[model samples]
Target chain A: MSRSTRIMMSVIYWAFVVYVFVPLILMIMMGFKDSKFIGFPIKSWTFDWYLAVFSDTEVLTVFGYSTAIALLSTVVSLFVGTWIAVLLADRKFFGRAVMFGLMVLPALVPGIISAIAFRIYARVLGIEPGMFAIIWSHAVHNVPFVCLVVMARLSTLPKSQREAAQDLGADPLVTFVRITLPYLRPALIGASVFCMLLSFDDFVRSFFLGGYQPTLPVLIFAKLRSGMSPEINAISTVVLILTAFLGIWAERSMRRMKKET
Target chain B: MTSDAPTQGAAAGTAAAAGPRSLWSSLARSQPYQKFVDVLFASQRRSFLILLLPPIIWVLSQHLGPIVQMVSVSFTDAYPRPPGQEAKFTFDNYLLFFREPVYMMPFMRTLIYAVVLTFTTLIIVYPVAYFLARHVKRENRMALLLLLLIPFWVGEIVRTFAIMILLGNTGAVNLILKSLGLIDRPIPFMYTGFSVSVGIIYLTALYMLMPLYSALEKIPASYTEAAADLGAGAWTRFRRVTLPLTYEGIGSGATLVFLISTGYYGTPVLLGGPNTTVFAETIAGFFHVAGDKWPTGAAFACIMFLASLALTGAFLSGMNRLSKGGRK
Candidate 1:
């Protein structure tokens, strides 16, 4: 940690940051550009493209589809993952490590592999490969993630509190509802938000399960493959803004937790 | 979405229970109902089952099920067979895959792509993660990590498009190169192995960096401080103290990047040309786009599956050996 080395590293870090941010800036910039093809150094800025982005029925419908998928998956994960976390935290069992490994396989496995598996599984189950399959596919992925978050939050609360509640004549259900659920509120909210975004932004599984309708990412992918258009840039910019806001909110909430603790 | 340590359910009986489950509260407190009381009071067994089953089924369905089916489908013929002609389940497709020679080049090139991309990403990311975890201000560490995560937040398809825009003939990169007189014309940057590798390294650097950063951050500063106090230089400290501590994380990170990169369809398809497509894209094409030949596509996928499984197994063992060595 010599001063010279530190300065050099800082310079390098800045370069990396610029490399990451520049493209995003360009995307947003192109969204506002009035040009035949997207290029650097904008000439005439206009909202016509952004207007087109919103007005297009296909985009709007896909946007709705994406939102619905995200929302449904998040809700499912919150409830099911909470129960799973509760079960794990409450018991001593054989094969604990193995069970835990299985829990996390979806997160580590590539999306393409999961998508392939889902496609086959849906066919076998006679489930139509459509929006339901897409949402369920996302839920399978999101549950583990949401459970991990909720479980972490649950771990922070002292065991003594819940044990004491039970000892004081509170039933197990009562103890869970009154003592446990309240403490997990923040985590529930955060994990839900995380799940929602994971579903909304996903493209891989959606691509496999897209029967008659496309999700937002699928729409963007199709549009990009067809031809480079500024409208897709507009959509990307919008998604980027939403993601940035989510990131900030998450961090701020985490900081608030640290302060309270 | 990827975490190894999660809180268990034993704690949740105390955590999630609210009021009693039934009207037997008074009876539940009585000595006669002590068994139910003990079960309710001791939230161990039920919690374990509840926490484990759903995700197990979910993952099995999503990860293992298709793979099994894919393996089954690959053994059959590609052409339309009669209703009962698909029974023998031979290894003909796999044998054909080897004998065809069409898949040979792409398969070999994919190996090179994974190795080159893994090395390139590791080379770039190690220093970046090291600096962020060690040298940055405490407040800035999280912000910097957030920056690392931003590109991932934007879907890969969009990022690919962005790369195309930058590297295409009339794109910003070429425009800059032309204006600088660095090149006579815009080289084929958009649909080549070069761009494919670059795009992959960009896409996966974060996954590799996060684990490495976590490992680095967990290493006690005191160890390195002790090294420096003993007159060891920075490079010596990095090699002796920092590197050893991060062996497990490095192994996990490298395995992740390598395995995913091998089966990649997005980067290769978007950035690579007809000559440079990867195995996954070919498999996908045969199934969905080319002619709906699921059997051949499944065959291709099975080859990739086995290859990836072998690679992951080797990585796991190698990492274990390294971790053992580092422990000394």
Candidate 2:
């Protein structure tokens, strides 16, 4: 590239980066503001907001509840998704395309539409709106992601490994448990973390399907509707830090696993 | 009779001699159970069934089931029907959307915004994606991409709140502008179409970037170099070589951004003014009301869903044709 073009590209790239970070930096800064109102010209900075978030029992309870929901939904999605991935990864089967389409349909449907659908469907099934309902919706939504990730990993598995296991007189179940599952460990871990984040971050479904209690995202939305506050900022910053750490770790570990193999 | 008696006698003797421990072991090692296990594992079809059944049931009952229910509900007169009230199937629920311009306005506005913002996001993100994919060192690309991805890890509400803080009346934008002598007063940036668009683009830009970057990254450097050597200018080389190769990426990213923008409820609700309401907020409005209005909401949602899917379908096919034509 020419020098002027190179310079222009650098400028554009940096400008975009600045655009991406400004809001986030502002968010983090607002968390430390002494005032309740969210705006510029910070008169004083304090950790009182963060301290308040840590001390608030309601917030702490919501945090634990959301974590439990994420964990439960992730486990369910991983189990079903890994099963589907294994099934699809096998040599071409009847209705494979149709099944794969059905499997991925949840991911394609808009969040609001699906959230509403789940709400209506839960009523039909006589499933009350609560933790189980939210987890069910989340798991269904997350299955497509888990299945796709696991399938990607499964595609890289060599056929020889399974064949060798079978030749050694291992049953299909044993071969799967001993040979295939181990190979899928990295993908499972990655998908689990991703699913946890997705389920935790989910707001629309949790909002519609929830009864009285709220997920973290729903809580933030409630607080936002009441109006923006430094408390919301502080809570958001805490979530941001956690998810960022988890995301980076998952990425690094996934890359390392790939390298090691 | 003699052979049966001797075997029976031995069984009784062993059972009596060995007591409960031997009896349990013998039962476990019995021929019938062993045969059952052998038969179960002997057939590939059986194993396949075992593996496929759970997912099939889940997809049918959980994934497709709710959508089917929504479709059914959309056709009915009312949902969660009042006591002793029968659900009358009618086309009226869907007719409500066409009959009232109130609903139609936001629906149309949503499609327009989605299309425009998708294109805008493409334009804004394409250069950044290209820069990262081609200009940056390979060793540094992943790190930079991760940095961009951090903001997206937080949920929609948090990110929208970020935008609010940035563009509120006394926000950073106004303060900066004032200090720089750009304006004497705050521009009322919050709760405007401009803010909503900005927020949507910020939220969905990562979706656009990933595909574009991957597409750009896969292009061999030699192709562009060879085009240049053939006396093609920069624009021509890029148009002829790079753009065609990344058409798939562009299609995917555009589709994702468009669909996401159309369905976004939180950002638009948070940032948009009364004049800037999107279809999702309108659809949500129905559910927020009495249960009798749910069917109307369902119908509206179905319309939006079908329209968005159809538009993206057409766009993708057109993109495919364009890329093919470019090759010829």
Candidate 3:
């Protein structure tokens, strides 16, 4: 590469990084700011907001709901997604293409529309909107994502291993458990983690379907819309860190899976 | 889990060999377990259905059924659901949607914003995606890409709030400008059209990057090398080979970004001023203040959904033709 070209590339690279990270850094910084107001200039540093987040019952309750729903949906999505993905990867059947499209449709469409559709369904069915409604709605949106991730990983596995196991007098289920399952372990774990993060971060579906008590994102949206608070920044910083940690963990596992295969 | 299977099998085999009358041998020869295994792998259809039924049923009940219900509600005279009145079928909701400039304007604006945001994000992320896909060292590329994408996983609400703080009256941007004497007063960045647009771009720009990178990365280097050997310059090689090869990806990325951005509710509501109303916010508004106007909201959602589908179909087909031409 020419000197000018190399220089230009480096500039663009750093600029992109800064553009993405600056706001995140700023958000974290503001959480530590003692003042209620948000801005660039830092005054006295304090951990009051973080402390307040721990004691805030409303935030804690909403967070508890978010965790419970995310966990429920992620576990549900993992099994369903793995089963669907295994079928998609291992089998050749009629209407496979159409089934694949239908399976992926929920992810392809916008979440707001899903929220609208589910809300309407709730109304028509006279189902009271709450945790039950929100968990299932989140599942609808997240199962496709889990399926897609696991399918990608499944596609990478060698087909010969299962055949070899079966030729060795192993039953089909034994072949799968002995050969395919280990290969898919990383993908399954990664998919579950991804689904967990997705469910935790989801706001659109939860916003509409959550009845009296809302999830964390919904509560945060309400708080942000009504007004700004240092407390929100503190909570958001914590959420951001948690998500980043899980994301990196998922990324590492996916990388290790790739390397292993 | 499978890693333990071999060792366990070997151990069981040794135990059975060492003691023919052992419990392990008996269990291995158990008739009920044998039958259960045979039944479990009985038929592919049975297994597929058993495995798939849970998710399929959940998706059908939660997603497809509701979508059908929502579409049906859009066409019914369900608005102003009086205390004792039943809804009848009518074309009035669709008519009002098309005829009213009030509803029509936001619909059009939403499309226009989607297009502009799609292109804007494409232009900004394309080079970065290309650099990551092609220029970065192979060993480090995945880590770097993950680093870039981690911010996106931070969630939309948090990202928007970050922008709100960055562009607020007393935000970092204004504070910096004021400190440098660039402006005596803070710019009205928050609650403005510019802020909403920028926020939407910030929230979704990475989505475009991932697809574009995957698409660009899939283009064989050999194709570019062949073009280069044919006396093509760098720019010519890129234009004739790289760009054409990735047109499908570009279209997919643009479509993804457009669809996601256009349906944005929180970003516009939080960052946009009163003047800036998107279709999503409008739909939410109808539901918020007036419980009886659900049909109107449902109609708006149906229109948005159809419009989005139409746009994606057109874009995909157009790109298919373009990519085919490039191939030839």
Say which candidate scores most in lDDT.
2
Model 1 clashes, total count:
29
Worst 10 residues of 2 chain B by lDDT: B20-29
TM-scores of all candidate predictions against the true structure:
0.87, 0.93, 0.92
* Best-performing candidate as measured by TM-score: 2
* Residue B145 miss distance in model 3 (angstroms): 1.5
The weakest ten consecutive residues by lDDT in model 1 chain A span A251-260
Model 1 stretches astray by more than 4 angstroms? A251-261, B1-63, B76-87, B289-292
**Candidate 1 i-RMS (Å)?**
3.0
Tens-digit lDDT track for model 1 on A152-177? 87777899999999799776766787
Q: First chain TM-score in every candidate? A: 0.95, 0.97, 0.94
Model 1 error, position B121 (Å) = 1.4
TM value for model 3: 0.92
Place model 2 in a CAPRI quality band: medium
- Error at B45, model 1, angstroms: 5.8
Model 2 misplacement above 4 A: A258-261, B1-39
List the candidates ranked by TM-score, beginning with the highest: 2, 3, 1
Across A1-261, the per-residue lDDT of candidate 2 in tens digits comes to: 788988899899989989988998999999999997888999999999999999999999999999999999999999999989998986698899999999999998988898999988998999999999999999999999999988988888999999998898666766787789999999999899999999998888998899899989999988998877899999999998998889888877776676666
